[model samples]
Target chain A: MTQTPVTDSAVNPQVAAAPVAVDVPMMRLHVKILRFNPETDKKAHWVTYDMEAQPGDRMVDVLNEIKWYKETGLAFRRSCQHGICGSDAMLINGRNRLACKTLVRDVAKDGGTVTVEPIRGLKVEKDLLVDMEPFFDAYRAIMPYFIHPTPFPAKEQYQSEANAEKMAHSSNCILCACCTTSCPIFWVNGSYIGPAALVQAHRFIFDTRDEAKQQRLGVVNQNTGVWRCRTAYNCTEACPRGIPITQLIEEVKREVMFGQS
Target chain B: MYKGREGQWAFLLHRISGLAILVYLLLHVFSIGSMIFGEPFYMKIHNTYDFVLFRLGLVAVVAAVVYHAFNGLRIILMDFTSIGVSVQRQAWYGVLGITALATLYALIKLIPRIAGGY
Candidate 1:
């Protein structure tokens, strides 16, 4: 690679002439988003916006462009712009994904048309934000915490590598609601505890030290529990964290059917 | 639809086939149960089933039953074993292949009946 020597004018603060960099390619994207305001609109509708965006931009970036300069009234949630916060999950191009994780180049076509919608099986509160209380309520019902009959060790409870490995895969759940909302069963029956809850339950249920395994099993063994999973595998495909949700749910189902070995 | 993959298609076909089998079962029960009323009534229903279209529909019902039975076993394997879960997508294709072959075999056997209108 050849380096160009910088002139004094380029480095001087008071310089009037300096070369500007505009070599980056920007593609025009047509974003169609679902819009609804309870206080204003009587029903939900879709609105499209055409704007210039980089092909490498994330879906969240395009939404940011629309919210920042195009339409300020747009409502959505995003705390950590990355995928870890478990927020900003939405239906992007007919699949559940984190806006922060999905890139424009992946979903956009030659014409650059992308459709965004709120995750299903929940009340859409605004344009992209849905009521998360029901999702959280299900997670709570699963008792997504460690419990042991004996008192804690003075330093820390010992867990073998093998024991930790059993629950390690299920521990990746960020509670993003991606898996739960993508479920076809949950779409029809809201009472179903859903995949996210099962993932959470699996996280603790498999723990060797958790004494509440039986109680937790009783909670998920209900009619609205693991049995509702029709094995559509949509949750597995939609999961941004790539957790084997269907497999874990199957394990939980087995545990419920024949007592854990 | 969220553009689900093979598992989604499998679940969908399973549901459809199960329903198709149920419909066939109900029709079969009603037609066969007519024997209690009289031989003529039973014969009349049986004769109606001999129509070319009904015979062709029977082939579809058989296909549905075959697909449902095999897919039910696949689902059972998936529920009980990790190997089944790993190979579910492949097993789905296998189920389709088996259903197609079974349907073809049924069609070949029934071709004489369907053509002769017996």
Candidate 2:
């Protein structure tokens, strides 16, 4: 390697100097995103962007690149960007994953076309964004908050450590629509309470302190509730928190079927 | 939901296979009802099943049944068992691989019987 001495002009580029030799090859990726804007467009369409990215760059960073440097019209949601907020969940390379959690190199195909789209079963709000009202409606139907007949104790309510551990996986949910949106049953039958809501139901139903176990079981006893789950395991696979969503849904289904008291 | 190709394919195969089995069961019971009429009527109805086209249909149905059964086991493992939940993608591949080989073996055996050896 030949050394070109750094001139005073190179140190302070206002003076200008000879261009430095370059060797690193630029890596590029094509992010194919589904775009829709009800205000201006009749239907959704595919839009591709050519982006230069590093191996470690996250999918949200790729969208940020398009918004910040390439195209300003790109739209998606992000909060903590650390998978905690679960706002950036989307379909990347044919699976639901957090945009901030998915790395650029991981999703890039061997031939190099990475498809990005809003999670299914929801109305598209815009590019890479989906209306989350339907998902939240199912979640809210599950009565995610704790419910008990008796009033609170003078101090903290007595919940055993063993009992808390039973609801550990269900408690990890951050309201990400990945599991629910990845469900085929939910896509065909929008009325079906999907896996995410079922998991939420399980969260409360299994809590020893909860007095509404019977109520939660009744909520999921219908045809379009936990019975709709065919155990495809797509929800289990799509969950970012590694929660056993299918297992939780199955527990609810068993409770519904056998009338567990 | 259908975005993931492998999972979507498995789910579709499961549903289609299930419907196929149910419809076949109805047809099977109805056709066997010919036995109540007499021996000739029963043999006449059963003879069509010996044809090449029906043999091919048999192979397809068997494939469907095998795929559905194995995939159901895979899903049961995923849903009921604690450990298999995490490696579901790999379990999916296992279901597919086993179904393919088992279906092939079934076809190979059925092709021989189609020629009237059995």
Candidate 3:
């Protein structure tokens, strides 16, 4: 493998003027990727690969490299290479992280093993791909959209900045299921409304513009609803968007406990 | 491997221990209620707590109470104060340590009593 200085982005020409005149250093990263096939394998197995890489490559890029040169059977989900898409969220090392966002260098700047696996609590359809229907089911149950009690105004209705800021952080959620799937509560009990759905519920619930507050509250207060959450904080740590998910759940719970007082 | 976070384990223990304690409380209340009969009849009741296994169960109940109470305090402090989420793991370790020490002291005091008599 060639370790040519990866000037993939040559915008900063000043970089080329550095006359150190040395071969680009090589990094060997041992990637232990979990593999499973429903048709054949009875259980999942770890497939570790020792490969050369640039320090700047993201974990997704490493997967791509493996798929490009080594294994054709590897599978995962990604669309936007940026963090916004939230498709490539997986258990990196131990915690959930978007493969597209986690730089390999950040994982191991000195080059070491990085384990990759599908997020827990979801059925793995193939390799890294998991059935997202369960996650979406919870999302759909929350009616993840704006609601209005009255007829539409002819013009836009204004909302105060403070009111808008209440739903601000939760509104940034990408529905990646990272926060929800990482939760131990949701992991063991699929009936529980997971963090992502609650976050989505929270997004519309606190919206001053939305008129379905009571309906939303009723839905989340069910037996398999927000009450199941134990404030574990896993969702907050796992969110790629860095939303304070446990706090949002708490806010909704508070609203439920003492309505509009 | 799924290496669980500290909060997850603590929450699990809190729930399990809470359930066990509830069971113990209900049974104790039932036994006390059974004392409404005559004194001789009440004295004829089984000495369940006199057994070694019963003593062990009591120790477990004591341990659970210690852990749940201390962890509850840790959680309360975090809620009321500006304590950041970063120290959560350390806080868990500290509370667990205190729980262990307290449980050990309770066992030391209770063991001799059980050995002596009913």
Model 3 spans with C-alpha error above 4 angstroms: A1-24, A109-111, B22-57, B70-98, B111-118
lDDT of 2 by residue, A146-212 (tens): 7867887789878898999989999999988999999888888899989989999989988988889
Candidate 3, residues A180-251, lDDT tens digits: the string is: 888888888988979999988889889988988889889998988888878688888788888988778877
What would the per-residue lDDT of candidate 1 be over residues B3-80, giving only the tens digit for each residue? Answer: 889998999899988988898899989998999999999999999987778979978988999999999999999999
> What TM-score does each prediction get for chain A alone?
0.89, 0.87, 0.90
* Distance from true location, Cα of A217 in model 2, Å: 1.0
Best by TM-score: 1
Q: Model 1, stretches more than 4 Å misplaced?
A: A1-22, B50-52
TM-score of each: 0.91, 0.80, 0.81
User: Scoring only the second chain, what is candidate 2's TM-score?
Assistant: 0.83
Give residue B63's lDDT in candidate 1 (0 to 100).
94
User: What TM-score would chain B receive for each of the candidates shown?
Assistant: 0.93, 0.83, 0.83
Model 2 Cα displacement at A216 (Å)? 0.7
lDDT of each: 0.88, 0.81, 0.80
Best by DockQ: 1
Per-residue lDDT tens digits of candidate 1, residues A123-235? Answer: 99999999999999999999988877788778977889999998998999999999999988899999999999999999999998888999999999999889999999999
- DockQ of predictions, in order shown: 0.76, 0.33, 0.33
Please rank every candidate by TM-score, starting with the best. Answer: 1, 3, 2
Residue clash pairs of candidate 3: none
